[model samples]
Structures are given as structure tokens and as C-alpha cells.
Target: MTDTDLDQSYSAVCEALAQVGEARAPMLLAMLCLSLMSRFERADQVLPLIANALAQSDEGDADGR
Candidate 1:
């Protein structure tokens, strides 16, 4: 999928999470992570990319960028 498709899918997931409420947020995140993990042939290879992306996002949010 293209970046736009990924962004839309992410937004849709956020909307679904909102509908499910904050109390279930952790469970939902865990379920989503595990579901994604199941598809990886070499999780180690992709984990650094995921970690870097998350770190960048966190930094951007912190800096209000």
C-alpha cells in the first residue's frame, strides 16, 4: 500500500479505538501489535524500522512539529 493508504488505515484504526473507548485502548493496541507481528518473517529486521518511526513520531509530537 502507498503511504496515503497506510495513513488512512491508521486513521480508521484510531477512529475504531475511539469508539471502543479509552478503557480498552491498551488491549486493542496489544491485539493490533500481535496481529501485525504474526505476518513478519523476520521481526528483528523490521523492528528497528518500527522503533525508529515511533521515536521520530514521539519527537515530532514533543516538539509540536
Candidate 2:
């Protein structure tokens, strides 16, 4: 997807989270991930993405950014 599409997707997620509120936010995200994962042809394609996201999350935690 293009950067513009990514921006739109990010905004959509933020909106969904806002609507669901804190209690169900994590569940909503997990559900969304599962829905997106179905579109992928293979686990191998998505495994690296999950790792990269975790790595980025770790870096964010390290710097407190």
C-alpha cells in the first residue's frame, strides 16, 4: 500500500479504538489483526512483520518515546 493508504488505515484504527474505549481496545486490535491475516497467502509473509513490529515496540520502550 502507498503511504497515503497507510495513513488512512492508521486513522481508521485510531477511530475504531476511540469508539471501543480502553476496555475492549486490545481485543479489537487482535480481532483486526486476525481479519487482516486472512488476506495473506502465507505465515512466512507475516511472521517478519510481527517481529519487526515487536522490535519497534521494544525500541520505543527503550527510549521512552
Candidate 3:
């Protein structure tokens, strides 16, 4: 996906989470991750992306969460 496509997708996800509200937002996001990951043929390809995401996480927050 291009940068524009990514931005649009991010906006859509934010809107969706907003609509789902805080209580069920985590479930919604988790379901989205699973749904997207289901399309990958190998976990090996996806694991690194997860790691990269974690690596880019909030450094200021001492607790990993």
C-alpha cells in the first residue's frame, strides 16, 4: 500500500475504534489483527512486523503493558 492508502486505512481504523467505543475497542482491534493475519501464509513473515511494532512503542512508558 502507498502512504496515502496507509493514512486512509489508519483514519478508518481510528473512526472504527471510536464508533466501537472504549469498552469493546480492544476486542475490535484484536479481531482486526487476527483477520488480517489470517491471510498470511506464514507466521514467520508476520512475526517481525509485530516485533517492529513493539520496537517502535512508547519509550517513555516504563511499563511495557
lDDT of candidates 1 onward, in order: 0.90, 0.97, 0.91
- Residue 24 alpha-carbon offset, candidate 3, angstroms: 0.7
Residue range 1-65, candidate 3, lDDT tens digits: 99999999999999999999999999999999999999999999899989887776755355665
TM-score of 1: 0.67
Candidate with top TM-score is 2
Candidate 2 on 1-65: residue-level lDDT in tens?
A: 99999999999999999999999999999999999999999999999999999999999999988
Give me the runs in candidate 3 sitting further than 4 Å from their true place. 58-60, 63-65
Q: Of the candidates numbered 1 and 2, which has the greater lDDT value?
A: 2
| Model 1: number of backbone collisions | 0
Which residue pairs show collisions in model 2?
A: none
Which candidate order results from sorting by lDDT in descending order?
2, 3, 1
What is the Cα-based lDDT of residue 21 in candidate 1?
Answer: 97
- Candidate 2 at 65: error in angstroms? 4.0
Native RMSD of candidate 3 (Å): 2.6
Error of 2 at 16 (Å): 0.6
Residues 13-56 of candidate 1 have per-residue lDDT tens digits of: 99989988999988998898788878889979679978998999
Worst 10 residues of 2 by lDDT: 30-39
Stronger candidate by TM-score (1 vs 2): 2
Worst 10 residues of 3 by lDDT: 56-65
